[model samples]
Target chain A: MAPKLPPHHSLQHSSTTATAGGQVHDDHDHHPQPRGIMRWLLTTNHKEIGSLYLIFSLIMFFIGGIFALVVRAELFQPGLNLINPEFFNQMTTMHGLIMVFAAVMPAFTGLANWMIPLQIGAPDMALPRLNNFSFWLLPVAFTLLLSTLLMPGGGPNFGWTFYAPLSTTYAPPSTTFFILSLHIAGVSSILGAINIVATILNMRAPGMRMMDMPLFVWTWLITAFLLIAVMPVLAGVITMMLMDINFGTSFFDAAGGGDPVLFQHLFWFFGHPEVYIMILPAFGIVSAIIPTFARKRLFGYASMVYATASIAVLSFLVWAHHMFVVGLPLAATLFFMYTTMLIAVPTGVKVFNWITTLFRGSITFEVPMLFALAFVVLFTIGGFSGLMLAIAPADFQYHDTYFVVAHFHYVLVPGAVFSIMAAVYYWLPKWTGHYPSEILGKWHFWLSVIGVNLTFFPMHFSGLAGMPRRIPDYALQFADFNLVSSLGAFLFGFSQLIFVWVIIKCVRGGVKAPAKAWDGAEDLEWSVPSPAPLHTFETPPDFKPVQH
Target chain B: MMNPVQRTVFRSVLVLIAMFAFAFALVPLYDVFCRITGVNGKVDERAQTLVSEEVDESRYVTVQFITRSGSGLPWILDVEQRQVRVHPGQPTEINFAFTNQSGSALSGRAVPSVSPSQASRYLRKVNCFCFDEQRLEAGERVEMPLVFQLTRDLPKDVNTVTMVYTLYPVAEEKAQLQAQVAPGSGGDA
Candidate 1:
């Protein structure tokens, strides 16, 4: 058999029969319908799918955000203002489960689905049915999971982590559905990853080398590979839980010759890579935005690729860092510690490169640039907190506390989520054929920045002061920080409504956009017509060949 | 030619795939490894008998349990603790059964999760099945087993070490959970 293409490289696929023709053909089969919902379900069109992903994620984002708001409302001034402890537990768990799995992740995957083929010049996803299958699985999985809230026992009150004993013997009746839903989600993720890998490897515009591809495509390529490698492990692990609950196995039981701690080991193994799965695409998006807005060629593109790859590899080896408080062996601890710390190097490389990319360049603070700038300041802060947690001894204090919570939220919220917002702001014009209202966009941006920091920043203090995670009620001393966080959460949740308004206004038609939305934007995506063609790049675009 | 990033991506995928395939083939391969080392938990078939008729002054059979992997999750191998006295050439049957009580899936084939350096050759009714790759939903319970023969040809010196079938939860279970949870905790949505 021919060697399978490398999952992360090999863009610029050689198309077989039909081409989208000159003017950058869309990499899809079906002709696009500029009209109805049928354009989404029956259409194999990449742009349509991408739009659907974005729209679906937005709805889920708001739904998940509502859950966050309720969480905040309850904790606003302490003493359960809006919900009981059980309801709070359900809210927090479902809030998190939905946002990450249903909202943010799907949004990014949508961006990738739409953009990857467009940028790389593919006809359509190599496996179209699989793509549909992946997206369809989301509703089924989340429906089962969200439906659990109305169940007799209430949804999984356990944290999203759902550790053993907590999810098993001690869990409510809904745990079974949660596990099965997760199994389906895992299957979806794996299928999505495989499709991405196939598309990236097999499809690309002529004369575009792997190194020559835009950073967004490059980062997603690695992220996709990470997804494929770990999702199956997730399926395998969940299967064990299924057996332990219904059948009779001692995998986690010491008395029956099983170890409970073993669950964590397996969990983190997939857990660590999963964090990158969320962020790596964001990395790609930020990379694209910064360069375009700053009016400069990306600095050290090759090094950026290496840094991303290194981050992915380091992710797998350092998983034990999360369990430092669980008592890993001294040698194992040391190894994980060093490995975790080393990630800082590659991560630092990315930060420095972004900063350098902006230096001495004609930088304008467009809506996209505004979010990009915020990402730099905030993501670095998140990274610093991460370094602090990497200290095994210090983690003993930070583990499961609000401090740890603050650190990750800083990374994920401002870091990953912020980048996503920026990408949408940047690409909205390309997809809609009109510019979103800058005034509303600015309102959305500033409110979100303030709201995000306000919501999560206080978590660090309360955590440092010893407020553990996952408990519904807390001591009076932690009341002040919780109040601030809750207020910030509501503000942040409301702020997003403006973004939806801006996007809707743009799509309905304001001022028609030009082929290249931004003056400084340099990419295959910009070479196409506004509101990009349905089946783009049926034929590859002409471009200068890479010198190297 | 692909650069280092591409090469690393390619190589790592192969390595991971190979690991998966290796994990899939764990039951038989692990058993073979154990048997080769005399750690297959099977007493020698042709070796001189430990329970000799001449030495009927109180014959005994002992089992041992040790854990080299999967720290602190409560894994054990239970043997019927009854002392049975039998005449020479009489065959006795003992069953080693596995029970998983943890909420997550436990991988049966992890290097050190199951065997304490004893009989590495463990057999199930099925081979290369997803049994070892267990995915336990909440409230899940399943049993695994090791069926063995204590032949009349067993060596006499091996009498007291308890036979322990260790348990190990696959690494991905908790890792995935933590990943899911951390994002949920920090997520804006």
Candidate 2:
């Protein structure tokens, strides 16, 4: 078969050779490019597609954030305040679905699309058209998902987990649409994961060995595998749900000779690995940032890789821990509890490795470094709470409570989301050809940290004080913590506007950046010109494996 | 004709499809697993014949009966005995009455669960009302018998086993089929 190349491949080659002096130039101008929005709608270029993914996710983050504010606002005084209980459930559900599916997961995929090929010295993703198809599927999926709110019965109110009986028998009329939307999203994820796997495995530069690849690439490769492994399971479970709802099957309906507990099992089986899929790439991003900011070779690079792999493996085993309150047998409970606790060891190794990398090193706290540091501390806090929740006996008390909400939000907002922010700040110079304003960047970071903490920290107290989650109102005893959390949520929600402003400001104009933006950075992506040309590595760059 | 990149994509896609199949496979796998370990408290569907064996008089086990009506099922279930103390290996009989309050005919099925689920396998039932649909006409009432025995080797730590039977309304079409096949068969005894 003839080698698949973009229509502008020859023009891209000419432009690369034409710019030997390494000055930043628009390669798209040299080539006959599609005009207007058509460029984005039909572009096969990885970098453009990457930008599309990022822009799309940023918009979704705000949308999901607004939904969360609705939920928080209602809980501000805790007495059917801003919205009714039914609408409140919809807000919470939509917030979780949008953030996890649209915002966090896609942001990671966007970063992967942009950086993986460049980091690995490849021209573009192995299947560029498939990449475009995958990214486009997300909007269609979410639009259908959001449109369900207007479909008479409201959108999915069964929580993101959408347990059976509640999600099937008792669900609203719009649930069929919810199932269809989730199916589309699952397909997009599987396709995206396939492209990532194929690109990493087959498109690495001639000399770039598997172990020699950046931690981001390694983590994403594993994450892609996880996605490929579990996304279909999600598809299967939802398909069963569809059958139960419309076709009169009993995959999860207890009334139809099916077990409700089975739904929890199947959902968590996919969900547990899904948790790692979001965070493993975050690990990759933090690993990349810490070494650059610390100006040190990453401590225990091999262990870091092994720890990630072990965490992915352990993720599948520990899923039953989520079902601890569902009256699992003692043996199954003990088994899950022990496996869940065992996950902490590998996670702890990663934390210690990051700290050790920072130890006595000539370290500079750039905006990215600040976020990375917070990720290390706060993610560890999330991990500790996870360990607490892993104890079966303890989980019975903490399950379906605000503490569970707090634990995950701490990990997701500070852990995964923080890592994404750090990555963007670290790489905005490369993508925009301008140094982001340090003052503005720092302002965004501090406000975000405070807002995030204020929003989630009090949840721990309220949950322990007997406050249940997914409730629109709580008793007066839990009033103060809810007040603090609501205020914090709003504070955190609005501070993100500054993040968008930073990106726009940096993109429009800032201090012009050199080819190597960070003094301590060492990666193949750094070798490319800033505001990376529309096409990069058209001719493969010789890669020298770093001596650890 | 496929290159290595295409091959990798092909394999990943295969993994995706295989995992989908694996998910569906889990349904039967879960059933088999539950049956083997009794982790889900699902007892055997097949009835067992009464086996003549010595009753373990040294041990007394408490068997508690709880009946719940599922949503949309306008039926009242009354268990003659709430709790029974019986010797291991001794056969026990319990009577349960079902009354349909609805104005029309309704068909319902009872789903049973044995709590402290590990004890599910040790509790053998020679006869059960859960084996078939319980169809009743307007204001009709029916009484049924549940004949069961606890095995002689009941675990010493398991002193109490709770059996919960939840009754669910069956669809009208299936209820009509049952009426045509077995008319007035499971009525008051």
Candidate 3:
């Protein structure tokens, strides 16, 4: 007979008796963990793999941050003293590539590896070995890209977007290496996405219908779908560039019956939605944090889900918003403008849902919530800037300048990076069964917030006053703003070190945590034991649906 | 309940089908999308300027071709390179021929852009397909040829409009691939 109770231990097997020592054997089997170095390579455990990815991402984050510090260091007093202009361009490009692909992205991926299955009541990822492959490919891809910096002609100077002709015949000798690296990264993304989608779709508990799933699952599911949808487009664009460089194709050359403008269309097609891929997960993290800190069931779960899907659909139409300054036909321009404006509707829904979730609820300002609140404020600032950029004619001026730089940094730093930090604080208890050092986390949060604003805010004025982006050096008029931004960059860079410190202290051991770490935590993740083991939700969880 | 290993296999097979179905639907959906959004490659035409007239004044001539385009990504326009024998230091006009075979009407202007890779700026235009877009409305046919001169600004030898252009398609498979792949690429946590 299929024992119908939701897969828990037999009452006799679950006896409260302890073994000879203090260890409990009612549930866990002592699978001798392979000793030492061999463990990471051969291990298929999701948590182990997640820690590996997280540590690797942090190291890359600092490496990428050092590059940002270099860019800032150059702009500190203006006459280009620390490095040559050419090298400076390389720094900016490398910084962007490393942060997006290496730091922010992997952080989220690591979190997903650790939580998604636990959150949704699955035993393992839909694909385990492929998980190992995806994580392994990252190091290889990054190594190739970093190696190109040492190449004869120097690494890619065309910026992370790598627009062509600039990336083509006019490119550095290492452009080929950059292209190959991106290709590998794309492969990794596709495989990883396939695994996520499968796991979510098929592995939920019998009663955990889609709506019953946590917001994190929903957001990641959407994120995975978007990845499957767009990573290929980026690959295609890079492939065309590769061909144009080696073979003679006019995909970007107008005189050869090709248009360079087409390259922008293709890149932004993948690029614009890409920015969303980075942020939507942040929204999910904040959603979880706010409810827990506020002690409330999320006020409008369905609305949040609808809002995310709407934002995704709208993401495709609004891609051309990035190309507004590139000069398209007038009608095409108008269409993109309207499509871009429509996104605000769904975005408004998300913001409203979050506020409602917080309203009237008992609110606590934990470190995660502190980061989440800052995200709301700063991310809103980024959004408002985005709205301003959406206006067609205004974008002509803002297209390739410091204002755009300010806009993205605001979104990415306080927006995406803050969320990642928030996630670490929020979930560390669940993972380590201990609260991180509250004091250290606060220091990290404050320094990051102040540092980020100082770094990015002044760029708006310099951009308005006519300083272009992606340039190594700037005219004297733009000096002071650059100085403030650079100082902010250093502060922001060092602030992240505190995150490393806090996480280490928490993981090593701190205040003990109970099963439901937070009083208001309602997700299935909390139903399992904290310090969620090598495997969990080994059967499935049972929970009553939160009635509307 | 199945053992952890067995449950994983059962779950994996189920999830794979669901994901494949989801990805499979995207192609037809995306195509339907292109048709609807008119994100389609478009066309606009403009009246041409008779930018050229053979001058009888300076007997010295140079022959060159110049290329220009409505799009930014380079396009592969079929340029027929022919040896147009001209006198040294003579300002001579050479006609360069090009065909736009792409589904979208190709728009481009050519200047003998390749040389000492210099003097290209003054390599003026006569007639260009890029005078406006040639809307090859689907199977619509159009010829985008160019006319330019190798200016006597030649130091004894510059003579060809190796107008190298790189063409970019409106969309590529890689972008489509990335779109499909990125979300699932991360860890299971």
Clashes of each: 86, 0, 97
lDDT of 1 by residue, A1-548 (tens): 11222233233322222223222332333454334555355555566667777888888888888887877787777565667898888888888888878888888889988888777766566567668778878888988988999999899887777677677766788888999999888777776777777677766766778888888889988998888777766666667777777775655554343446666767777788988998899888888899888998888889899999999999999988989976554667789989999999999999999999999999998899999899989989999989989999899999999888898888888888888889988888778778878889999999999999999989989999999987777889998899889889888989988988998898888877787899888888777777776655555666565432
Which residue segments of model 1 deviate by more than 4 Å?
A1-39, A546-548, B1-189
- lDDT winner among the candidates? 2
Report the C-alpha lDDT of model 2 over A440-539, residue by residue, as the tens digit. Answer: 9999999999999999999999998879999998999999999999999999999999999999999999999987899889989988888787668876
Tens digits of lDDT, candidate 3, A1-548: 11222355444321222222223222223665555676677566677778878888888989999988988888888676889888988999999999998888888888888888888877667667788888889999999999999999899888888888889978998999999999898778777776777677777766878998888889988988777777877777787788888776666764454557667777887788788889888988988889999998887888899999988888988777888765554677888888888888888788888888889989988899999999988998898888888899999988898999999988998899899989989999988889989899889989998999999999999988989998777899999999899888899988888888898899899998876888888887787766665556655666567763
C-alpha lDDT of all candidate models, in order: 0.71, 0.89, 0.72
Predicted candidate 3 versus true structure: per-residue lDDT over B140-180, tens digit per residue: 33455555444444443444434433233233332442353
**Candidates 1 and 3 compared by lDDT, better number:** 3
TM-score of chain A of 1: 0.93
DockQ of each: 0.04, 0.65, 0.04
Count backbone clashes in candidate 2.
Answer: 0
Instruction: Give TM-score, chain B, model 2.
Output: 0.89
Q: Give the TM-score of candidate 2.
A: 0.94
Residue pairs clashing in model 2 are: none
In candidate 3 the C-alpha lDDT for residue A158 amounts to 83
